[model samples]
Target: MTASTEGATDTAATTDSGPTSLDTGSETGHQTTAGGDTDGSKPDLGAAPDEHCANPGPWPLPEAPLLELPRFVAHSYIDLDQIGWMTKFRSSVGHDYSDAFERCRSMKHYAYPIDEVDWGAVELYAPVAGEVIVVEQERYGSRVQLRSTLHPEIDFVLFHVDLMGPLAPGATIAAGELLGTHYGDQTYSDIAAATTVDGAWRLISWFELMTDDLLAVLQARGGISSPSDIIITQAERDAMALCCTNGQFDDPEELSDWVPLDAGNLAQPTRLGLATLDDDDGRLR
Candidate 1:
């Protein structure tokens, strides 16, 4: 039913261009079963010129997304030293500073502060193909919202971004497409995953959605054994009290001296629903 775009079938161009086009060759979606082939017969993929291949990225939509860092570098400030999940922080209104110990609370949130890194030259890639939802300009950058194509139930927001081009509603986005360029001397952004519950959109813990493989990749690049070592705990809070009168480690680097907790116990498993977490077929990694 879906028409194949011109040059879409060319494997060489597809690889060079990063699969900007989707192949709609079969009416039932030309995907193979877990085994080599359903009938135990290998599908003829011609040669490199005529080969047909599936898009590389996440699987079964976005349950356990294969995420690329905002920047192309294997590692960035997003390293274990800068990321935080389930950490207690002061809630401020209108960007006003508040008491850290008295106003601190724990909520599911992820923060990556790439303040020292130069991201102005890097292109931001769309984590998934989705419709543009909201666009807002901020002091340091622009905030763009996209309705996830993989999961209509979830909404994704990218803060502190400079869009590559104008993206209006109803426009189709391709996975791995360059959404925009990030520009800033001191840049930081939060990628939040929200879902509607009881008719209201609430922030959900994405820490669990981060797959073990991805975590290992990050850990290797971050020069740490586990990403979970960054998760703040009551003991970390006590350590902060020893240094600061207010008991707050405003700079994440302050906690670098603390020992990394048992990563295996801290990591939350992926929540599987309609989608699966299998890449054993060696087709979708």
Candidate 2:
């Protein structure tokens, strides 16, 4: 639900208190480009024996993170604007990654935590220094895409933002620079990254490329303790049954689409987060 729709209160409502579950409907035509494995039949979910599964390259790729992880939000916790409670990968609380890159792909990208702060109180910043290749203006807001200067294949994406500068295909951007203000009505920031592989864009959590110091900031502000605590591996996510309907990638169900953020309690009977979750008990939808 990070990509705010104009009026989807029915499906995008805050049924509970963690992150808003989504109902993409036709509003997400912009993000409908999930390729590689969208044949309606769910992936093996096991070890992904087939070859079509997404290929996640080495972590912290070289020339990677050409710049430090830029701060996306400008709010401070000392001011009572609690900007925490972000959902990790394979957790469908943001956009639907039900059918991401390849069979073994986790369509999910990280949603930067911005809970309880005024909508535009937080300013957005570029997390990487690269060349702007795509700048899109949508009904709700603007989105920008940048390719790494060092590694052209790796792309950094930011959605649901009102761009700050005159960005075009050939423009250059430095990490930590102001991208724009937090647009729309959602509580968090959305960043879904991908890499070009075999003529297709394969989903890859950009945070996986973060330096140790960068990840430490995530651990300090949110409920995260370790890298594994946040990232939902293919096997772990499949076991949780956090999937979407055959063709419905946007209309996320409470249990089916979203994964719980209980960092260490993977096998707990019920899932929990920083705040109290609804009594839904997280039954597989």
Best by lDDT: 2
Tell me the spans in candidate 1 whose CA falls farther than 4 Å from its real position: 1-116, 222-227, 230-285
Each model's lDDT comes to 0.35, 0.43
TM-scores, in order shown?
Answer: 0.44, 0.57
67: Cα error in model 1, Å: 21
Which regions of candidate 2 fall more than 4 Å away from where they truly are?
Answer: 1-82, 98-106, 110-116, 186-188, 242-285
Per-residue lDDT tens digits of candidate 1, residues 28-88? 1123233347667654533321112232211111011223322211212123433322222
What range of 10 consecutive residues in model 2 has the weakest lDDT sum?
276-285
lDDT of 2 by residue, 32-144 (tens): 22222666543333332222323321111111112233323221111123333345665645333422122222344433333345656567777767787667664445657
Error of 1 at 18 (Å): 32
